[model samples]
Target: MGKQMTEMLKGTLEGIVLAILSVRPAYGYEITARLREQGFADIAEGTVYALLVRIERNGLVGVEKVPSEKGPPRKVYSLNVPGREYLEEFWTTWGFLADRLGQLKEEGK
Candidate 1:
């Protein structure tokens, strides 16, 4: 994808990642695979990891090491109480912005 599109998509990456984790906890690679399968292939693999680190640092999510039978133990991430609260706030704000955008588009027509 071009730089502009990638930049545009960046803003939503955190929300998308958080939303996925909300359904179930997952490690980095699993999250990347799920995002690709769900049509977010344009997102670079590193971007997801970076976002995860940022979210964790922000105290919105927490991580724990889970032993893997086949390979090294993996760090699994899940939403914490703060994460759920942030997600709720994000949903409300996004919903309002989405409705306003739709109305503006209709008016422009």
Candidate 2:
């Protein structure tokens, strides 16, 4: 990943994961794949798992262990009520930041 992209992702990765989960439940591997498919190709698999652990610890999401055909049970994650609320806040914050940045960019032009 480019330095700029990596720096940009630092603060936004959690919200990105939450946004993904908000759409549907997914396991760690699935989440990683989805992120990659969505253009976050540089995100590491372990990073997603670490975020999952943090969110689970913080009561933001719920987990279910489902049997996987290829291996052991997969721990699927879905957004909980708190997670939904958090995601809403994230969007609000993101929008505010984006608007401010756009204004600054326009001013610089």
Candidate 3:
């Protein structure tokens, strides 16, 4: 993706990460891999780790340390109550924006 897509991703990435965690708890690398599988090839592992730290600090996620086979233990993050509420708000706002944009596009046609 280019600059514009990257910029847009910055605004919604937190909500996206929360949505990912709603399904299952995962660590930073796992989240990055999931994002890539979802077509977000430009999302870096470091970025996900930073976001995870932020959300953890904000009390949006519950974390547990799970020992890995090879490396150190990984901190698996799961969406908490506040995180789910935030995700709901994000989707509502996204739907509003999408509707407006769709109408604008249709008018331009």
Candidate 4:
């Protein structure tokens, strides 16, 4: 991907990660898989982990260790109360921004 593509996607990356976690609790790898399946293959794997740590630090999310049926323990992540609230705010703002951008494009055309 080019610089512009990265720049365009940057704003929504955190929200996308949070939105996925909202559906269910997930470990890091599981989150990566979900992102790939959702067509975010261009996202750097390290970036996801970094975001996870940041969100956790920000008190927006919580992590719990669950015994894995197969291998080692897994740290499962879920949205905390603050996370849900933030997501709701993000959704509202994103909707408004997207609509405004669409209107601007239409007018430009």
Candidate of highest lDDT? 2
Candidate 2 local lDDT, 8-28, one digit each (tens): 987699999999999999899
Q: What is the C-alpha lDDT of each candidate?
A: 0.87, 0.94, 0.92, 0.88
Error of 1 at 14 (Å): 0.7
Q: Write the per-residue lDDT of candidate 3 for residues 1-109, one digit (tens) a residue.
A: 8999889987699989999999988998889998999999988888889999999998999999999998989999999999899889999999999999999999998
* TM-scores of all candidate predictions against the true structure: 0.88, 0.95, 0.95, 0.90
lDDT tens readout by residue for model 4, 1-109: 6788789777688898899889988988789888888777777888888999999999989999999988888889999999999999989989999999999999998
**TM-score of structure candidate 4:** 0.90
Query: What RMSD does each model have against the real structure?
Result: 1.6, 0.9, 0.9, 1.5
| Higher-lDDT candidate of 1 and 3 | 3
Extract clashing residue pairs from model 4. Answer: none
Highest TM-score, which number?
3
lDDT of 4: 0.88
User: How well does candidate 2 score on lDDT at residue 16?
Assistant: 92
Clashes of each: 0, 0, 0, 0
Predicted structure 1: clash tally: 0
Candidate 2: worst-modelled 10 consecutive residues by lDDT: 3-12
Write down the worst ten-residue block by lDDT for model 4: 2-11
Deviation (Å) of 95 in candidate 1:
0.8
